[model samples]
Target chain A: MNITQLPFIKEIYGFLGHDLVAAVIGILIILVFVPLNSAFLVWVERKVAGHIQLRPGPMEVGPHGILQTLIDAVKLMSKEMITPKLADKFLFWLAPIVIIIPAIVCFVVIPFSPLMQVREMNVGILLIFSFSSLTVLSILMAGWASNNKYALIGAVRAVAQNVAYEIPLLLSTMSIIIMTNSFKMSEITAAQSPVWFIVYQPVAAIIFFISTTAETNRAPFDLVEAESELVSGFHTEYTGMRFALFFLAEYTNMFIAASMGAVLFFGGWHGPFFPGLIWFVVKVYALIFVIIWVRWTFPRLRFDQLMNFAWKVMIPVALLNLMITAIVLKAL
Target chain B: MIAITDIISPVLVARGAFWLMVTITLTGALLAVVPRNIVHNILGLALAMFGITGIYLYLGSQFVAMMQLLIYVGAICMTYIFAIMLSPPLELELPKRRKAKVITAFFVSLVTFIVMAQMILSYKWAPVTSLSRDWSIETIGQQLLTRYFLVFELISLLLAIAIIGAIMIAGLVRRKN
Candidate 1:
């Protein structure tokens, strides 16, 4: 949406060129939205996990730990951004920034509401998916650059895991895109007015949920950063703000993945009584809450089992689902 | 805020950006060839592909740009990285004869470039008068199925064969282990 639609913004746009005005506003939105949303999601995850385990989370911080993540953010910012002396200096420095860029860029095309989006590209879903895949490259860089065996192993596992799960993820999403016949996020949402896609494409929805959890490195699929096994995985040597950027990007990715799920299967922004933005947020959070809950509930999967499941089961199932979807679409 | 048009027109900005992309593409290509490190070479190739994606975007082919990013940077580069990381590290030392080989490679590439440039310059390119302006995903799908059906099927068959070949090679290694 054009910020210049507002009278005050229109005045500013008259002084600045429209391109500059839009560019500035888009940057500002990402700057504010990414960190703020990440902080909020972190708080929500902690609170939900705490309650799930029958304890109050961050009670000492402001009421119900609302201010806890803010305090943590402050602490993280003050800590040292240490670089390992023997590490590849260029790649070590580049990895965290590279990881975060894709996470932030994906937000630009996300249709938050009918009126709220940075840019509504025709290939929005494709753009997000393509950029998100770049995250594995950063992870690999981070791991390899650390000059640590554990970090390298973690990176290898991450690349393997992401590469395997991505097939199922794309296949399932292709099912929905086939039905909707467009890659645009807004069109996908609009097409779901009659019924949420979860009803018709339950298998795809299930596969999507599973792969997304793996995609974001959450819980069961989080072998990339399995603390007990790999000593904090790919970001083992990263500290302070560098670590915080990875942490923030992880949460932001979780948010984006869930938002995509909501948009694809949960009838994004389509609900009674409430406005579209509110409904959209509600659906997204509901998915995020489920993700967090699942994280706290399940044990991490074995590395070999993860690969086996992706290849032997999920890929075939997702492919079958796609074929059926195409046949049905053709018949209709 | 100074108006961008006051210093340089929009067309000038676009032209400048186009040239910048071309420079990036060439530099990346040079890096891919000149780097001794295999990883650096892979990353340089990725950079070149990304610059080409930018060129595609400027040419009003957003779909193709996204696909290029998806297939080349996301899939192909990652595959190269995986193979690099998985395989044993190579010895850095090269044979003396490699210098002559490198010169021959450079000469061949230069000759090819000149031939391609001459061909491009001599050709009187004309836009197809009946070309459909629709660049949407739907139209692309229709064209692929109707106009390019056999070629599309052939490409899919080729991909399937490649995948099977990869699986067989990987299986051989596993069997050896």
Candidate 2:
């Protein structure tokens, strides 16, 4: 039977028969997947960082400290939530929720494999970028609501950094979209099956990778949460689950950026001797590993240097790459 | 989870969502003008922009909706927040409450709203005969570069000028300071 032809549950308690059913199941799956994936990534990152520094990471909680993050999660949940006395109460609470929602919503449009996406949005790439940009607003809110000078400075730096990096990120991505002629994630991935964009557009790939790192506030660009400088930056006053939520959003955003990088430049979900889902996961994790490697390997750039790199170097290069892609596409 | 679809049909669901978006937009508009705090006002503007994005989605333009979210909520709202933060604190500048001015402003706004509503209600709106259903990004791009080429170039020029002027003004202010 055609699923679209299924009868609507006319009764209040009637079963969800078709599209709604699929949507509900998708939401449930995502709800389970986001937190689990983020938790695992946290564990992996710690292990990777430790090994990079020639040390063994957490080994007490679970095998090779695999369950350490879960234990930390529990501890964070039980901690007390503190609101600064002079903070704007409404915005202080709203910021964390805002940050988390976009992080999860963008996941719906991310195509893991041909059959594995919550919603194959028509403009999936744009949707993800747009929603991801909301992270800046939340950081600003968190900083301002904390009523701390350090937090405010951190938030300002974050906003400036994000705005500066987003241009090159979008421009580089635009080159791929021009090549693929579609904003849908699945199409971008499918076009990459023969030869991934990284071959033709090496410069864009590099620009995209660098900008994604900055966009996610990963290492070198993580001046927003520079512990040594700003006393934990924007979330200086947040404690308990509130702070945990911010952390979860950050990690999940990193995952999204990596996945996007995989889909855009690398041949996503395409490999020999493995199922498409496995291939997709492998590519994403590989990108994530590189990001982690870069995070721990490189020293953070100064604020002025970061800004100059984006505006002076990345943007102009991306624009030139985009123009070349357009001319080549037209000539072909 | 139980399916409440029997009680709420698809049409009902869509209508509910539409009304919710409208309510959000209206509330945000109210908050934007009514809020005493500059931060609240900026947030309200962002909320309204979000609501408008939903409306654009319903109008079958996902690309425009995303652009709306990106440019207005992401870039413009952040700029406003940064400006507000850099400026003097609200507490330092006490606003003088004038009952007569408030009343006059309210009266003017009310008259404008009524006139606009009346005009909209009386007008016999007709759907365009040659409505193109091509809401794709490609079509939009082609149209902007082809049919709307001059307008597009003009808009870009305007934006470039505005940005340069802003920077020049800021530089002058910094020198004076």
Question: Scoring only the second chain, what is candidate 2's TM-score?
Answer: 0.80
Task: Score residue A136 of candidate 2 by CA lDDT.
Answer: 95
Give the best candidate by DockQ: 2
Write down the lDDT of every candidate, Cα atoms only: 0.87, 0.87
**Model 2 off-target regions past 4 Å?**
A1-17, B1-7, B95-119, B127-132
Per residue, candidate 1 scores C-alpha lDDT tens digits across A126-158 of: 999999988998998899888888898899888
- Determine which window of 10 residues in candidate 2 chain B has minimal summed lDDT: B126-135
Give lDDT for model 2.
0.87
Listed models, DockQ each: 0.38, 0.40
Candidate 1 docking category? Answer: acceptable
Q: What is the TM-score of each candidate against the true structure?
A: 0.91, 0.92
What is residue A331's positional error in candidate 1, in angstroms?
1.6
Query: How much does each candidate deviate from the true structure in C-alpha RMSD?
Result: 4.8, 4.2
- Candidate 1 chain A: 10-residue stretch with minimal lDDT: A1-10
